[model samples]
Target: MTSKGLFVSFEGIDGSGKSTQARRLADTLTARGHEAVLTREPGGSPGAEEIRALVLQGDPDRWSAETELLLFTAARRDHLERTIRPALAAHRIVICDRFADSTRMYQGLSRGDLRAAVDQLHELMIGQEPDVTILIDMDPAAGLARAKSRQTVEERFEDFGVALQEDMRTGFLALAQEFPDRIRVIDGNRPEEAVARDVLDAVETCLP
Candidate 1:
């Protein structure tokens, strides 16, 4: 790998299996003799992980959209400093589970119409964008059911129910269009192995 490295992120609605795919990509790349650093947003570094708990747990309305934005930005900043940048500098492929685009959809579009604010803050603080992003698109109802079945403490977003998931799916698809060069949309309603193969093909194109 070149010193410049490659940054990749996996995105999708909850239960769309993006996290699983991200991990698989990292493992696959590593096995193929590449140095791959797999991490996640809202909780990649220590400080960010703490912020993740705050935002992901408790009641659905725990924080206002504006406040949540601040927290997410701060966490991302810490994650970049502690985890992402170093790995990139070392010529490692950074496969992130979720990144700024997730924020653009979840906190920016879903919580409220704060897309402008999200963009401005991102430019000012975390200006980095993924070299490639794979978005797993799934049916809102089925995705919601899968998310709810997890029964994890991090179900605050899931608690908002299927209505929010439906809106999120539409928002995410629009986001893919907005950043066509960087984001690739993949159908996630199929078998996991098939989705993984598609994801690998997508990332391989961007590999150095």
Candidate 2:
């Protein structure tokens, strides 16, 4: 079903600051008299939040890649049903920080054939696609360094070593290439405000 509201997603490596840019874009929309719903994947809904904790708790040694993918998909389904869909129906712009794109990147790096997984997920859960997805691109090492410098506590992914982080960045770029029309690649090595401006510009093209 089609709605007046637009669904936009922000995607990037851990320290790319997609969350900050997403919030800024939402604020921009609100200031312009538009309703915007700012949310995130894997924890947007109650059930999703539960799944998020399990997925991010750093059990890669215990969990298989397919298991990880399934968990992520389950969370995404819950998020879609309880949060995204209703907001869209209400004509609110949904600006999501790390949606299916993250799944494609991380899971794709974990396994392979990310396109197939994305298709399966769409068939099973996500009935619609985002109108636009801004990909904040950055060097994995630099991004991870920034993240570590800012954080007081480390997460599973953060502690996964440099190789995995590099894989994730490459995976994201591949996914962006696969969906060029839907994904806008933004250089995230710049200042936060500059990156935010680029994101806003990308979002403007898709907004009504």
Clashes of each: 0, 0
30-103 per-residue lDDT for model 2 (tens digits):
99999999999878899998887887775446466677788888889989999998998898899898888787
- Candidate 1 Cα errors over 4 Å, as ranges: 1-3
Instruction: Please estimate how well model 1 matches the true structure, expressed as its whole-model Cα lDDT.
Output: 0.92
TM accuracy, model 1: 0.97
Using all chains and alpha carbons, the TM-scores for the candidates as numbered come to 0.97, 0.91
lDDT of each: 0.92, 0.82
Local accuracy of candidate 1 as per-residue lDDT tens digits, 1-208: 2358999988889999998999999999999999999999889999999999999999998998899999999999999999999999988899999999888988899989999999999999999998998999999999889888888999888988888888889999999999999899999999999999999999898898
Residue pairs with colliding backbones in model 1 are none
| Highest-scoring model, lDDT | 1
For each candidate in turn, give its C-alpha RMSD to the true structure in angstroms. 1.3, 2.0
